[model samples]
Target: MQNVYLAATSATPEVDFRFDSHRMSLKGESYPENAQAFYGPLLDAVGSYLAACRGTTIQIDVQLAYFNSSSTKLLMSLFEQFNQAALAGNHVLVNWFHDEEDDTILEFGEEIAEDYPALELLTQALV
Candidate 1:
């Protein structure tokens, strides 16, 4: 599958998904006017990629400074996809990076960890 790359905008995060390498990352902030429109294609791509893989190690890194409720819902869906991939026997590792002072982001990461036990979630505090 071809890789996916979306440059970061003021209201959206940068999406870099390298299917060949099984690595993906989202950075910056996400509060798009239409969260579904922004995340739908990404979710499709990730689902397709995960569906094609077996016994692969996938690394996903997310470092969003801020996001809105809509973005939060979509982000959880993204993590759910990874969790499913892990349940299918792939080694999925998700690294959630947040500012040291940002309890919200850290808490969100913790929530993901709690919700998705199949995938390994690493909450990293950025200083």
Candidate 2:
């Protein structure tokens, strides 16, 4: 599958889904005017890639400083997809990076990890 990359904007984040390396990263903030419009295709691409992978390991790094409620939902949806892919025999690792001063983001990551027990989730506090 082809890789997907979107530059960060004032109201959006940078997405680098590197299919060749099996590594995906999303950084910066997310507060898009239309969350679905921004994330729909990205999620679809990820789903397609994961569906096609035959026991391939996928790694994801999420370094979001902040995200609106709508974006939070989209993030959860993506995590769920990853969880499903992991359950299907693929190894998925999700590294959630939160600012050291932000407990909310840490808790959010923890919540998603707890919700998707089958998926491997790593929460790291940024320096």
lDDT of 1 at 8: 97
Q: Please write out the lDDT profile of model 1 over residues 31-126, one tens digit for every residue.
A: 999999999999999999999999999999989999999999999999999999899999999899999999999999999999999989999999
Candidate No. with top lDDT: 1
Query: What are the per-residue Cα lDDT tens digits for candidate 2 across 1-127?
Result: 8999999999999999999899999999999999999999998998998888879899999999999999999999999999998889989998999999999999999999999887889999999
TM-score of each: 0.98, 0.97
In TM-score terms, candidate 1 sits at 0.98
> Which 10 successive residues of model 2 have the least lDDT summed?
47-56
Q: Listing every candidate in turn, what is its Cα RMSD in Å to the true structure after a full C-alpha superposition?
A: 0.5, 0.7
> Residue 18's C-alpha lDDT in candidate 1?
96
**Candidate 1 at 114: error in angstroms?**
0.6
